[model samples]
Target: MRAPYASDPATARGRRVPEDESSFRSCFQRDRDRIIHASAFRRLKHKTQVFVEHEGDYYRTRLTHSIEVAQVARTISGALHLNAELTEAVALAHDLGHPPFGHTGEDALEKMMAPYGGFDHNAQAIKIVTSLERHYAGFDGLNLTWETLEGIAKHNGPVTGDLPHALADYNALHDLELDTHASAEAQVAALSDDIAYNNHDLHDGLRAGLFSEDEIAALPMVGPAYAEVDRVHPGLDSYRRRHEALRRVFGVMVSDVIETSRALLDDAGATSVADIRHVGRPVIRFSDPVWAELREIRQFLFTRMYRAPSVMKIRAEVTEVVEELFVLFLGRPDLLPKHWARAVSAAGGDKLLLARMVSDYIAGMTDRFALQEHARLIGDG
Candidate 1:
């Protein structure tokens, strides 16, 4: 029942380690299940999206953000007659490699690991699935369908130039067509990420008291949505007013993506999944007007919330933790966990390889774990 251009699991480029097809599940379904059960997926529950994990119970974690993205992706994919399951799979796995404390943690890791094939979460996600997840007896990683790996590797777009070393190494072993775009489902997942984060961050930022309703009232689409909600529900409680307005904003984004993508799909005349890859531009996107409005909303959030003094204070503290931990592990590789220690030892005193292993260990840590590790190792606990 898939649309002509939908990624059909029946003809999926099979896993690296070949195996018999599942009797009950499509390849994408199996991919989703495997991702759900991964150790990295479980770690997401305590990983920060914007707010630190210990900041509040209400803020979204990487786990919840991934779920929200999956929901948005499924909705858009279903509307477009695309493979919703594959879209969901990609969405769920999209943030698997984000370090603790949101982008702050990633920034620290990237800086610390700059000498050793710099850290990119997208590339780290591919590394996690293709080599880090050692579960199955026959394979070290999930051995996901080729499409799933491609989506994880290139969901944003093509990797046409110098690549993250992790991605480049894996691409050498099993080509992910680094020069081309991922499937349409991946494009949906990527856009869904945008819709979910922008909307939810606005909600979280408001709830955190980083900005007031009046402050955001001058922003683009968000301002109009808030005004409309207030007009419809005069004197509504602050909570409900905020909820109504944000939900409208979310709906606007979804509607824009669906409407714009539908037109693009029709125009492209792409009758198969391969046709999507060669379209040379993403078919999933918001209209120009909506995209500009979203940019304004993002600017508002950036000034009022993301870079707010309160948040940046914590960002500085967490960045210090990541940097110290990287130095600690690099200086004393034996301090890493047993398996990580073995890998460091296997590196045979190659400082660069050992640094990369330390990067992997730290990048895998949850916010709480990273903080605790920093304390325990650096004598602040």
Candidate 2:
């Protein structure tokens, strides 16, 4: 049984483009299913998370990372008696806007499109569900429910400042209430993302030899987890040792969030999803100690893994690919895919509109496809 404050599908705000309810699925379940089947969702398979897609099979691609986030989200939401389906839907769709080479591609796209309204993955995600993912004959986008759209728009927190153009455009048509906290389920999904990425990056970095067990041994949560693994399994193989240690660290983080959130919810006394949203503070979060320790861990990964020499070299190369593709498409829209070219031509000589279309086309590419297109159009030699 869910808590009183849980988002009830019966009271859901409903989708922008109305449709008949499914007999077997809750509205949120249908949302999750639609997101799973989206072409953009499938493209995440080859998009990088930390390591490039071609680096190794063990590294987390965007698709794997999203799946992990969903797993964590469901676990947290289920424990909190929140809507696990809505949380999973948000988690799965969160990274759909991430371009070819993860953050590198996003940064490059932001730079290239600075004059045409900056690119933001969060806002791009909102755009994708509302206008870009044209799966239905009646609508341009998926026409997801309001709660899901709000979760996608402000899952990180309230958007009080100038919104991204993509988000702004949609908000004009149907306001997502960007200036308040999301549902508890959405809050759970957001924190779950933090838990998944921080833990997975440590595991991936260890496997990549970007950093050693010794390197992470001093970090908070890492130290105790490793010490326990060593105490229990002396002289274990490197693979098993790393796995055991990281799993312990992951457990600690998850436990911290759940315990902290439970206390916060009790204090807030929110009796409905609206009450949870308007409470003026997040109901889901890590404890103060855990948050600080996570900051240290993130700094370690940023310095030793994200900015390592090998990763930086690839970052530079992929940034160039994104920039060149953006400029090439802007200069010669005719070179875009036939369907994209038709869309550009239909813009009726609006360069800004053409640029935005090019941005969408380029942002949807997979890493391998982006590299191939770069070589094909700009030539590797």
Candidate 3:
């Protein structure tokens, strides 16, 4: 049997989402099915999570990341006795907001649209569910439940020191029912994102030779983890060859969350983000030691994988391409999509709306599309 918290109905603080299945799946599972079938989810296969979309045959694409998140969240949720359906749905849709080319595209577009309303993948994901991509109901978007929308927003939320989005700020309305339903699942999704990416990014970096097994072992808790990795699969660990190593890493993530939550259940009401606080992070979280190690690994990745000469060669080139293309499109102004000019909510008239619209459009483009457009307009034979 599942843990007893599966039926929890707390508040936005940490609660169980009510669900009723029709003939097959529970409501949240149905939501997951709809997301899986959506064009947006399919498009994620070709989108970026960290690296360029399609740049490497073995790199994790956005779709793989989403699937992995779902797996991690589901396992964690099960262990914690949270509603698995809600956890899985939240994990699957959390990154639906990210634009192509990962943060590279997100940043370029954010700058271009700063005048209108700075672009953000989270807000954009909400927009996609609420209004974009018209389908059968004569509605462009998916019409996801309010609970799902709230989970998407609170997944990572407005990071520290950042202003909230207009939607979040102006319509910060809190519906008790939706709040009660979204809390646990949202946390599961958020924590899963961290857990999945941290471990996988490390493995990916190691495979890329951005760092050696020995180098990673020298960083933070990486020594023991690297030893565990080697012990799990002692052979050469290439992206193509480390199949067993990859599975071991995934297993570590599942066990970490499960054991961490079980250990912290007594701290369910801790006071602060730093207070050795609540079990399960009130949403998605890990134990103190696990989190500390992940943080150090994150710092190391920034220095090794991201700032290395090889990755910089691509980042420098992509940064130029993204910024140049944004300027060109914003300069022309008329290239704005017809829907954007007409349907936008901004009252600053067509020009402002067009800029935001252009940013969204560019942000939405896949790495290949962005590159092709940039080359067509800026590159010479």
Question: Which candidate has the highest lDDT of all?
Answer: 1
**Model 1: per-residue Cα lDDT over 1-381, one tens digit each:** 678999998889999999999899999999999999999999999998888899999999999999999999999999999999899999999999898888999999999988888999999999999989998899988899999999999999998777888899999999999888899999999999999999999889988999898887788887889899989999999899989999999999999999999999999999999999999999999999999998988888888888999998999999999999999889899898887756876899999898888888998999999988888889663
lDDT tens per residue, model 3, 1-381: 544444222222321232333575555656678788777787788887667865687788788999999998887877776677777877888777777778767776677667776777877776666555567454445545555566776666423334324344423443322223235556778878887887778777866778876676676655655566677667754543344444555566667777766666534543332222124235345667767777787898899887889877777777788788777776765555566655444634467655655665776677888788888877842
What stretches of model 3 exceed 4 Å from their correct place? 1-23, 157-166, 169-182, 225-249, 263-266, 269-283, 336-349
Clashing pairs in 2: none
All candidates: TM-score: 0.98, 0.98, 0.80
lDDT of 2: 0.92
Where's the lowest-lDDT run of ten residues in candidate 1? Answer: 336-345
Candidate 2 vs 3: which has more lDDT: 2
- The lDDT, on a scale of 0 to 1, for candidate 1 is 0.92
Could you arrange the candidates by TM-score from highest to lowest? 2, 1, 3
lDDT by residue (1-381, candidate 2, tens digit) is: 999999989889999989999999999999999999999999999998977788898899999999999999999999999999999999999999888899999999999888988899999998898888987999988888999988988899999787778988999999889999999999998999999999999988888999889889899999999899999999999889989999999999999999999999999998999999899999999999999999999999999999999999999999989999998989889898886766876887798898889899999999999989999999974
Error of 1 at 140 (Å): 0.7
Worst 10 residues of 3 by lDDT: 7-16
Give the C-alpha miss distance for residue 248 in model 2, angstroms.
0.5
Ranking of all candidate structures by their lDDT, best first: 1, 2, 3
Q: lDDT of each prediction vs. the true structure? A: 0.92, 0.92, 0.65
